[model samples]
Target: MSEQIETWGDLVERAGVGIGGTPSDAPVTKLISAPIPITGSDGTKDFGGCGSGCGCMPQA
Candidate 1:
């Protein structure tokens, strides 16, 4: 006989589709602050201005 599914969590559990990481194993403490530099490149790009000739302007 087939198993009965009551909720989405039950369906996912029955399918056995997961990476095997529980809530307790989550990297909650590994989070970083906004001031942390992710890359070596300094975000100081001066895009002059978004004039009609600017290619960066969204075409709408």
Candidate 2:
């Protein structure tokens, strides 16, 4: 497992593509976030995020 991780690190370094394709390692701080928090949702609309549905609703 360590060997595989080392190989991946070498490629990522050569390709200049950091882990997850992130531009560079920088400390990011979020000041603001979602204003209205989700209290409840029917979640009937399927966004294709899951194979079937959000699990709150039964699958057809």
Candidate 3:
């Protein structure tokens, strides 16, 4: 069986144009950010950071 491929233009044509306009409400004028501290071990757990089943040896 053959499969038919769809395109973005075809989908947009079927859906038609959408309502385009900015919301008539108050907009956010201020921004706030809180940096989170993170800590972890040096990636030398599984295969010494060489991924599982990888044949890598640690430096002497």
Q: Is candidate 1 or candidate 3 better by TM-score?
A: 1
lDDT, candidate 3, 1-60, per-residue tens: 132315444334445853235332323232222122122255434334343433343332
lDDT of 2 by residue, 1-60 (tens): 223323544556656875675434433343243333323456534433333434433334
For each candidate in turn, give its C-alpha RMSD to the true structure in angstroms.
13.4, 10.4, 16.0
Q: Itemize residue pairs with steric clashes in candidate 2.
A: none
- Alpha carbon lDDT at 29, candidate 2: 43
Which candidate, 2 or 3, has the higher TM-score?
A: 2
Candidates in order, TM-scores: namely: 0.25, 0.23, 0.21
Write model 1 residue lDDT over 1-60, tens digit each, in one string: 345555445555667876354542333232223333323345644433345644443334
Best by lDDT: 1
- Please give the distance, in angstroms, between residue 5's alpha carbon in candidate 3 and its true position after superposition: 6.4
Clashes found in each candidate (C-alpha, N, C closer than 3 A): 0, 0, 0
lDDT of 3 at 40: 25
Ranking by TM-score: 1, 2, 3
Better of 1 and 2 by TM-score: 1
- Give the TM-score comparing model 2 with the true structure, all chains together: 0.23
* Cα lDDT over the full model 2: 0.43
How does candidate 1 score on lDDT?
0.44
